[model samples]
Target: MTGTCGSCGRDDEDVVLVRRLYVTPEAWDTPGKVEQGDEERWCFVCRTHYPHEELGQA
Candidate 1:
């Protein structure tokens, strides 16, 4: 699927599926690249921003 990456804002066909959990304000009080509880397709570059464990990759 073609869509813009919520992280890098890249509009390309090369993308990977990413999953994130819903966190409350207290959990994400710090300023960082935290996803707001949703699954989205992100490009390879943007995908690298997230942790490998969270991606369910070995």
Candidate 2:
């Protein structure tokens, strides 16, 4: 699979994989809510600048 960096927008072979979670307004109001999301690949530059557990080196 190929994708661009979430930050630098680079689609190089080496990049970071990250997922985004989005919750509906109603879900947010509930005590227990499930989030829907998507995954994205980020460039090495972004991974270096912003490192997080959710972002995996691809």
Candidate 3:
């Protein structure tokens, strides 16, 4: 099964899946290496939707 965005249907907008890339300790310590990855999509609408977080701020 693939991850899907709740609002839209885009693999890139998948709020569930995070395409992570793991590297060894040494590799991680290298000059330039990626430790994490980008997001997978569930919907296309995710591209247009804005993330709303509430921290007592507007």
Candidate 4:
């Protein structure tokens, strides 16, 4: 994946974290539809000078 780095003005694969959501289903072996309400975004260290801005307290 490619993204423009927020800082240093460079284009690279800076984001390292795997962006996804974890959901617990009522049944162990069944697949259920999930409501899209939350999204997790990840960026590289150099990209986010102020990392707190991207990863805020939930």
lDDT of 3 by residue, 1-58 (tens): 3455544544543354334344444455576444554444333344334342212211
Per-prediction TM-score, please?
A: 0.46, 0.40, 0.23, 0.27
Q: Candidate 3: where are CA atoms >4 Å away?
A: 12-48, 54-58
Model 1 gets an lDDT of 0.57
Order the numbered candidates by TM-score, best leading.
1, 2, 4, 3
lDDT of 4 by residue, 1-58 (tens): 4654434345665543332333445687877544432334345655244322334312
What digit string (tens of lDDT, one per residue) describes model 1 on residues 1-55?
5667756787865666667544334445665443455666667776665542234
Candidate 4 vs. true structure, TM-score: 0.27
Candidate 1 displacement at residue 56 in angstroms: 9.4
Candidate 2, residue 37: how far the Cα is off, in Å: 9.3
- Report the alpha-carbon TM-score of model 3 versus the true structure: 0.23
Which candidate has the highest TM-score of all? 1
Error of 3 at 45 (Å): 7.0
Quote model 1's TM-score: 0.46
